[model samples]
Target chain A: MHAIQQQYWAVRDYLSPVLKESKFKEHGRITPEEFVAAGDFLSYKFPVWTWEKGDASKARDYLPAEKQYLVTRGVPCLRRATSLAYTDADEDAERLLSFGDSSGTADEWVETHAGRGATVDSAANLGEIDDIPDLDGDGLASAMADVSIVSETGATVGETPDLDDIPDMEEEGLEDGEDEATMAPVVPKAGGVIDASQIGVANGNLLQVRTYDVMITYDKYYQTPRIWLLGYDENRTPLTPSQIFQDISADHALKTVTIEAFPHSSTLQAASVHPCKHASVMKKVIERMNAGVVEEQLAARKNSGKHQDKDGKKKWGFGRKGAKEEGVKSPVEEEEVEGMRVDFYLVVFLKFIASIVPTIEVDSTTAF
Target chain B: MPVVQFAPFASLVQPGFWHELTRMKIDVLRLSEDAITVNGSYSVGRSIRDRETGHDIALGCNLTVGEDAYQKAPQLSPMSVHTTGIFKNFNTIEDFKAADKAALINDVVSKIWDSIITTKDTSLLTQFLLITFADLKKYQYFYWFAFPAFVSKPAWQISENGWKQADEEIQGHFQLESIYDSLLKTTRSFFLVKEIGGITEVGSIEQYEEFFAGVAPENRVIGFLDPSALPENPGWPLRNLLTFLRAVYPSQTSSVRVLCWRDSERPTAGKPWRSRFGVVSIGEGDPTTKPSAIGWERHPTTNKLSARVADLAPMMDPKRLADQAV
Candidate 1:
């Protein structure tokens, strides 16, 4: 593994304490793959990718077949820290062919590297990379195509191909041969609003999806819900994909903008330890929370009688937790608002708004 | 011996006046050349009667003569000597009236004889009395007037028409006009002497020296004047009495001084007294006569007489004296 990848794992090891101590695992496990994905996502959104790119000699090599076929076409794969599967393919194609298994292939391979037992599955036709289906039905090929294309080129897909007549690819689907129709923009359900009740299995198995489970785990553990772009401004106008990416990229570092869920009242809400400067955003968040739109799932588990002692004995009638419980419904019920759900898209949108907005400092030296 | 000539004043008078004058007893005894002795007595009697009852009583009359009674008596001018006696016993108004008439006749006769025989020029006496009285009345005023003149006039001219002259002239005019009024007034008589020597026997030589050294010219005079009258001389008797009383009693020393000055010439043995005392003299003649006589003495070595008069011209000027004194 490259040094940065090793370093990333080391840092991840350090973060595991905070995650475990915060009962993140009890909420749901965040797999190594997921952790790396989160890191990669943060890196792409910030300048961290530059730090992740180490020595060029350690750059990932591709298979001969992949170099001949997939690279001639256009697709990108991450190469700074070589994936073991890709590295294994250069050493032994037969052993690396295990990645072509039918189900949980990536999961099985990752489990073996982690020194865990793996599940066996039937050998599946490694389908024509271009013919692989997108689970999101977003009309783009499977991510496997990205891996294959990157391996074949032995060069990053974002760079130009040797054949000048060949069509060029844009990081966004803007090139002539880019197949813009296949790269269907996520319309975000036309003003989709996720309420707190939809956070569990009821709302189309939200926790089953890795992204949603990650978001929910983060919400339960850190009381920080991951927010996605809802394709709208505060005035509820749809934003283009370019605008959504631009907004998200610009505010990737800010915690408030990265949270997914919002309160389910009349306004939107996000949480951060640091004070927010944007009065409108803060006010909206506060109004939504006050109006019971942003449901807090752990309100009951958090000692609804806020006066309870550390040992969980009630010291007085409900305080903060009681107020929160009174404002929110149980996780199974809908929030009674038709189009309100504190979901990832809204979390990202709110996060983008929050990051673009400035932070405020008050008499911070004083205890509130 | 020089023939003793007496003016025949006794032959010229009426018999009753002469008889009354001769009836006055006159005893004179000489004790050396400088002293004399005299003794005499007089008495008066009256009858008392009751108006309602016809009761009558007779007062007794007695007289006795003391030895040398007048030996040391203050020397006075002859006009002051007089004597008379009267007696009466009555039971009614007729007798009392007759006795009163006799007493009045005796007093008038004695006074006339006294005026006739004792005429030793009373002018000096009168002037002295008037000036002393004036001084007592207005010494401060006179000092104020004289002081300026004394400062302005020459030292010698101070006695000429300066303060002293001005003082005397002012006094003489006032006296000439007011003498009759002063004499008619039944006032006690007083005498002033400017020079200690003008008195018969005053301070001894040593006493005189001491007195002269201590008493500035402004303070040398001795006399009394009526405290209410201005420009009248205090008589010699009052001056001598004040000096003698001041000496003897020593307590009356603070009484104001009054001096009388006249011509610079001495009085002849038989002439009316002419003298000046404690006054600045202006003439160029001998300074050792009368008013000047006060400072003269016989020189012990040469036996020659000389006068050393105080330069009183300064003191005669109130301003000069005040300046020098201050």
Candidate 2:
């Protein structure tokens, strides 16, 4: 196993007892395929500052010297971990089903389904995965007959199936009835859930149940993660667009981007939608892009001779002399004007997702 | 010694009237050969009568002689009768006729003889004559007799029995003459003449000059000479007599000196005398004195007596007296 995989298991084992005391039910353990898939997702979405072997000095020389190095580096890692923990792909379906059964009620069926392992990606493909083929090719005629009977009984009784019947095919249609009434399917989009269980199979590893009761316990210790992307219009007036897209696109370079997360109780699916991780990476990329854009704008103005004084002096007017001395350059003209030159800007993006599972068991006899 | 007698020598002067009166029925004898008998007499005749019988009353009368009878008698002696016989009146002739004439005559005769003969001795008669003459020299005849009469009565008496007894005893032995002598002695011996001249020796040539020196020339010294001492104008001699009297008997004549000069000059201006002799005489037994007049009288003369003091020294100018040395 990879060293990072071992660390993940250790952290999981350490937190498992605490989670169990808090009534977190785990159906099984996580498969190695899931860990790799989660790692891939984190790597793509939350990249760290990279340097060549000798480039450490170069990068250090290039980047602005700041006192808080960990704040600039380790914060990205932590944010990434937090987001992955809330990802819907990390949910355990069987655990959610068992949770539903222990709850002993059916009124929350729709909410339970929504909170389960189904992601936007899997939800959209519900139509293709709706029909399950039997294990033997006898069409599972008796099991289908029992499922039809249980379905009929569930329609009549509006209650969960018996716990003993859940493994039997008789309770299948009973659970199916509840799913059809509550969970409306979704269409898949890009950058959606990537199934890590499949990776375990391809790697010829024995399949683990992959049940993880990832409870995103929140307290004042964990603050809400939010991203604030500051931009300006052509008039140099500050702009805060309520529409997230507009805020991201309005400025080619974001001036000030920050991400913050609130304290909350959520599943890993909810945490995965947190924008803190995305916000950290996008901040650096946006800074470079904005620096280029502003420099271009400043150059264009210079070329056009738009900013000039009446005395025909080039007016780097942002930090210029006072009106009394038309030609005399003030000290601010060198320091402030030079400093305010568009070196960089930043932009932040954030997403958080939480997965919740509620499992229900319907009694096949109750359907009649 | 054989009694060989010589005839008397006759004087140039004839018997005076006093000699003729004193010689009546009296014999003069020379007791010794050298003795001169110039006969003089003093005859005192008094009539006696029985008041109730209205008849001539006679008692045996005789003349007894003294040795110095004639010489002691003054030339102008006056006769004086002093009667001491008592008479009782019956208020009726029958009652007088009824009385025993022989016994009455004997009684009358013995009493008259006893009264007359009692003063017949020589010394007694001499003293009588001397006293009578001295009195006559000082006062009138009436005063000489009246003074004895006035003084003989008790002048004052105490009403209390005890004090009355004492007064009686005092009167029984009292001698007015001795009292007079004491008064004179007290007066004259220290008689600080309240009068100016009486205070010092005065009326002599020396004292006279001193007195006149104290007077202004315009002022005269009027000497009041007594007329009885005629022809002599006896100023100094009389004053010497008074001094002799005071010296001989200070108490009898000391008061006499002041009484004699009581009305004399007072020593200051506006009076009869000027500051004569400048001597102040104080009346010593002036009831003002014997408790002692020295302090009271001397204080007045030395301090309060105002005198027209004159400078008597020949060398002192009269202006000096007016200069008010005080």
Candidate 3:
């Protein structure tokens, strides 16, 4: 098992008391698998979600807090850390991952090794590391050997980590064997409507899958439903940030968009957070979701038989579970309409976020 | 000397908002799947959502005098429909940061500060008076209002002349009313009234009460006070009327919230600073010269400006008072 996988399990183990101690399961513990599945489901349901890829080889990149966990549990390959999953136009599409600028590269990883009480430069750190009598042969020694190589180049830690054809910061490369020009806007020929079905993403790198479950609750103030996700990959593997960053559409990346908050209620006195440019893609995505098949289906449902109850009451969509409305269509149709407002947004949000992560369906995803 | 200053006004609003928000203790407010907590209590930052249209709106911070900061009641700007979801719906920090720095910070601060209000147990008592600032076409001014937390918000409904579309059935005229109506039931939180315009003067207290019947008597009342209209002594007629109403029905009237906004550069006082518009709050500026004042009033129910004359008459009456005494 990868170190993070073990650590994740360990973390879950630690929370076992809180998870199982309470009289209710809601306060109790869930298996690690359950958490991963929930996180995966949530990543697909919300507009604001990132599939994180933590690099185990770059173990130094793990925060000081997470490092002790990494060391004890053995290292994990967290290549999926903070990444997103995407699918091409295929209905049975394989998920490709798009990674973001995550943690340390080769040098930083090497530096982190040095930071572990080495208190010295390349050779000294190496010498000090060697002083430890229990060098487990080529295992720790092998990974450490890469650090010496990282130190020799010092200047180029310069060669840049082999990005594995990950899209560069410019996001100009096409790894999915598609025409480079396709990356540009498709420029809809039919009015302002975009056929979401036609949109396809490159599988530059396959995203490692994890199982997770979703728990939802409302925010106290915003009155907007906030989705809470939990879970991690089964193998406990993590992804390189570039694997995720490479998949981000040029528009949604930082610098193309921003969310501003006004000081008073006035937009004019608004304060902008993190000075990065941001894209205005949410509305456009919603428009596409709105102009899709869902609207037609809702309209059809409204017209076909389920119009009003015998008492002449307009059928309100919101209701508790097991609520019967003149036996409307079926249990499925009623839920579709009732959850239409939130679900439609989630569906489109799934697609938009997919543009940010690579979509790879490794066997690990299904097996788990 | 004038009491308020402006350079810090840009930043002061956040702390001021937090200060006001600390008083609210809501139980639960669900946007959809997410439940947010404020001041250690479940609360919702109220905004409107249209289920069918997918259109949404949020309460804009009233910039009239920073009245939103003063009364803590915000309303959406006239052009805000276009900018609603990005701030509230962003699920990722990266996505949030990409939207707009100010907006992202605003959103983050709003989210992170939900339950961070300190428990200063000083004034846990419910305050009924609230003053909010607002803006209209070309008007920007203060609004004094009173809507206690115990009153339920009124819902909108349709009456007669209900229009039907295609296969949909037509009910009644789409008149605004509360969804669940019950003037008698007690509410958990205070009701909030959101009016569009800034500030304006009324002919009399009776006319004021009648014209703004949308604001129920149970809720806290706020108004856009125009102290300039008062005579030499100005007799604080509005405050007096509220005090009288409170004396008649102590359960409804508890406290009053006052807000003032004006251009400080006038010959009025101390060296002026730059501001789009300035606000003078109770604890903020120099009260000596700018004078944050409060007075009282009481008269029999037979008075012309009696709240009973208005449509939103309190449940109390002289007969009830006499019966209680007996």
Candidate 4:
């Protein structure tokens, strides 16, 4: 962003009001305490995730000790979203499957590409890989010490590793049975190095997979859980911001994904999914899930040989919108959705996030 | 048979490790840059492996620590072999860069060598060194890890039969459950497995002097809970173990059978857990001569001998701190 804009944001962030009361049920926004509660539930449900007390110097007093943010490591992204057959020719699929209303047209979307005002490969394609001078052990320390590595632009220009020659991990214990678990992505070549005939033939030998260390922190301004991703290539080398963008769905890649500082750690600048519309999307998801629960309960009652007319006056757990066909009447939809505990907010939030980055097999939380 | 090449131990530093280091710098040691003993754990399973390549899908070895890393007595996990490492936090980036890396490596390697001759402590085989510079103000940590492995004149090789997955019959004879139970009960990563008639028994590496005294050279079976997923080669810890073994018994080098113990968290019923057996051949070694060693983790992206930087200012910046609180 522009220097003035960044400065304005810093001032605004510093002056942002603290949310004291919970508006989780009404606006889908949560307080810091509720964020911790949701985070706790997420960690309890998925043991892969754990709460970490970040740098003590930057510790926030509002959050509990040892519970600054949530993190799950080595979340495998087997294939690039663009390389997957399901997503290769399907730009409209991302829109149709979006958790938000589908009424918004593609043209209405304004791309918020990261590093726009910055100097980190602002071009569409990574043209010439910058020769990031190889500094030996001692030189690297002194070299990096002089630079302002904290700035978003400074981080991108720091160490852009050669994307080509992605080292293949040793090949001794490979069994044929794991083929089902691994996906084959068209290995990214150095600037259209391979032609059509050599599409899969040239780079077909090895499976190029990426692993992500996903971090979730509460965005106080947005009052929603914002996710930040630190991705590593197949060889465990840090992926460049552009390389990381390949794994994100194209629709969200241009619009939502932006390079920003991870809250818990100031030194790391990771690609974060913007939380501008998190509450709206979450509100819709909560309603849909509530409706689904009502359907299941209605179906169960019908299968249980219960007479609906006898219990006509009985209050149903859900509202009467979808219940008309089942001949069951209940309270308002708002009351039915109130049953959703705020603790499951993150779990439901991830359900929609799966659409944004479908290639990342991160949300394996018991099918939600 | 193919000559066995050990897969280098890939350093996996959990973010918590850095956080704990930051806490130690601020709360415990303000300006002093002394070497503190820390712990790192790695498991045989949980490796993402490619079916085609005997190599692990990612770099192997998760040398990680958690919040309780610096606890007076850190609790060890049953699934992994916990190894003690030296953590040296430098006061400045210049000091970290100018630090005697070669001397640092030699120091740890000598410790392993000394333990081999004097104490015969097998845990020293996995001794590692971690050097770092934590820029607490900026919240960026520059660190490098070295898992020192002693070099042999003639590297260890697999026998003509090569390494093979132990069959159900061999598994039955060895008693997999007993070994698994023994591993859970002790912190010893290296152990001796002696099968008398049909009963299998597991003992600590410290008892190697007495445990294998009467056993024939051919019957000497050394089993380690290997952290690498590769079936062909064992993890890096085996290097020093073999070196120590060679120093102790140079005559019986060819007769030792190595059982690379690999365990899985979710074991499929009717299917045997991943484990391999191989006969290793190591050349004669002089205890007098200090063996050469090499193992310093490199920056993956830069591919240079560079220290890794973890920026944590977003969580620590005063403005950001005030933003979260107010």
Query: Could you give candidate 3's per-residue lDDT for residues B1-326 as a string of tens digits?
Result: 12111100000012123223222211221222131211111111112221112222221111111123322223322111111111022223233224332332234323222211232111221122222221221111111221111110111111132211201121111100120121012212222222323322122223334544565432323322211111111112122223333323334334332221111112113322111111111222211121111100001111111010010000012221122111
Question: What's the C-alpha lDDT at position A170 in model 1?
Answer: 10
Q: Write the per-residue lDDT of candidate 1 for residues A1-368, one digit (tens) a residue.
A: 23354356436534543332222122222322333333333323321111121112322122111111000000011010111122332233212112232554331211111110021111221121112112222212222123222322354222313221212111121111312111111111211221111212222322111000001112222223222222221111122122222222122223333221122211111222222222233233333333332233233345452532332212111111122221123231442332212221122223323223211101011101
> How much of the true contact map at the interface does candidate 4 reproduce, as a fraction?
0.01
List the global CA lDDT of all models.
Answer: 0.22, 0.20, 0.22, 0.61
lDDT of 1 by residue, B34-101 (tens): 21122222111111221111222111111111221233342211112211112111223223223332
Taking every candidate in turn, the Cα RMSD to the unseen true structure, in Å, is 72.7, 88.4, 30.8, 11.7
Quick one: best TM-score, which candidate? Answer: 4
lDDT of 4 by residue, B1-326 (tens): 44566655667665556666777788898899889898877766344432222233432445655555676555444556778888899998778877888788888988888888888678778888998888877666677788887666666777898877655425463477677677756735788987766666788777877887787665567988787655555766777787777877667665568888876332445655677788888555464466777677655444445566654454334443232221
User: Candidate 3, which segments miss by more than 4 Å at Cα?
Assistant: A1-368, B1-44, B47-176, B179-326
lDDT (C-alpha) at residue A256 in model 4: 84
i-RMS values of the candidates, in order?
Answer: 85.1, 99.9, 34.1, 14.6
Please compute and give the TM-score of the first chain of candidate 1 against the native first chain. 0.18
Give the TM-score of each candidate.
0.14, 0.12, 0.19, 0.63
Clashes of each: 58, 72, 139, 19
The model with the greater lDDT, 2 or 3, is: 3
DockQ of 2: 0.00
- Fnat for model 3? 0.00
